[model samples]
Target: DLLTLDVDHLVVVTHGFTAGLLVAAWIGMPVASAGHVAFPVPSGSITTLREDGFFHNRAVVTVGDVAHLVGVSGS
Candidate 1:
């Protein structure tokens, strides 16, 4: 599977009406991730692993943060 295509800034976006979001949060890779919704928090700030069970949320540099999901949306 191309899921491990080997790239930087891997993102996975899921519609507000799907379970994809939960799955993504459960398993994040690399070192950055976030959650986005249509209303209130249109986009979640980038979060990075911080100290002891903490992560720093910041701005996302690219939509690639998970647009790839759109391609497999129907599946």
Candidate 2:
């Protein structure tokens, strides 16, 4: 999956690594990450995860939600 965030003159970009971790957590999967990896992207980046819960439950978690992009146009 891809994640994007728009913040005025700057746009944040990040890979699915973090989001994947969230998914693993939600689905009871084994997750491993390297803490030494540096994030060179902007701080305003947003990542969203959609997953099915136990007993047919549904959940959505937005890390760094992009509410600021509302009504904005272009990329």
Candidate 3:
């Protein structure tokens, strides 16, 4: 379903563990291989996924970036 979407960019918000699975799926990695992969997605953190050109352009731009929370009281 995700691969069929015709959009230049999309946003997905989900739990940390689920986020890792989504990333693995987006990059065509085997689900089994993702078993050991961990994507740190703390509350309010941001992750970025990008694709460019046509073939083999997928990329993980950022993982759990909380720059905006740098000065937050509870961060």
Candidate 4:
């Protein structure tokens, strides 16, 4: 249902491991393939997921980006 949402943008707040699974799912990667892989999602980090107009182009624009946390404590 999430993939068919009509919103122009959406945000999902979840645990690190869950977020990793989401990333893997978005990219069509098998869950079994993630066993040995690591998707580090640091606290206060941002991951950008994109779907372009009409064509339904999907992609992970950025992953675990903490640039906004720069100069902040414990970042």
Candidate 5:
């Protein structure tokens, strides 16, 4: 049922900052410039981007989703 969806959108969330951005760039997607933020995205972090089309625009929905670790320790 998780694979069933009625909406037309694409979501990409992957590890490796450069690799993710590079793949998106290669596909002609507009990507924001990477910055040296004070807090870097930790390991196991999630970076999500959503779009309606594959070869068009995509917007970030959420980054670093740790909700799955709500009741888990050392998350």
Candidate 6:
């Protein structure tokens, strides 16, 4: 596993869906990521409430997302 090497910070830059993002965080490494794509949102799911993977309880770093979408909207 890429995480078995003991990465202190993981930067994932890819167009991955929500499930992929969740898997990345589940890896248990401090994660910093940026992606340009959509994350599936089902009714009552965390993604539905948060509206973005960056909003999840992970250390992912998302650049260029609609800032206003999460109340942290900024240019």
Over 1-75, each residue of candidate 5 has an lDDT whose tens digit, in order, gives 422566565454555566455445534555453232222355666656565466756555565666766777777
Q: How accurate is candidate 1 locally (lDDT)?
A: 0.36
Best-fitting candidate, scored by lDDT: 4
Q: What local distance difference test score does each model get?
A: 0.36, 0.46, 0.82, 0.83, 0.53, 0.41
Across 14-72, the per-residue lDDT of candidate 6 in tens digits comes to 44365556544553434555243334533222321122245535443432344344553
After superposition, which runs of candidate 1 have C-alpha atoms over 4 Å from their true positions? 19-75
Task: Compose the digit string of candidate 4's lDDT tens values, residues 1-75.
Answer: 788887888888878587788888888788789665667888778999998787977888998999999998876
Candidate 1 lDDT, 1-75, residue by residue in tens: 434455444554445433334344434522244345312222432322212224633333333233444566452
What's the true lDDT of residue 10 in model 2? Answer: 32
C-alpha lDDT (0 to 100) for residue 46 of candidate 2: 67
Clashing pairs in model 2? none
lDDT of 3 by residue, 3-37 (tens): 67887777788885898888788788897899888
Weakest ten-residue segment in model 3 by summed lDDT: 1-10
What TM-score does each of the candidates earn? 0.24, 0.28, 0.80, 0.81, 0.44, 0.27
Q: Which should have the higher lDDT, number 3 or number 5?
A: 3
Worst 10 residues of 5 by lDDT: 31-40
**lDDT over C-alpha atoms for residue 39 of model 4:** 78
Tens-digit lDDT track of model 2 for 11-51: 33446455445444544454453333422322455655453
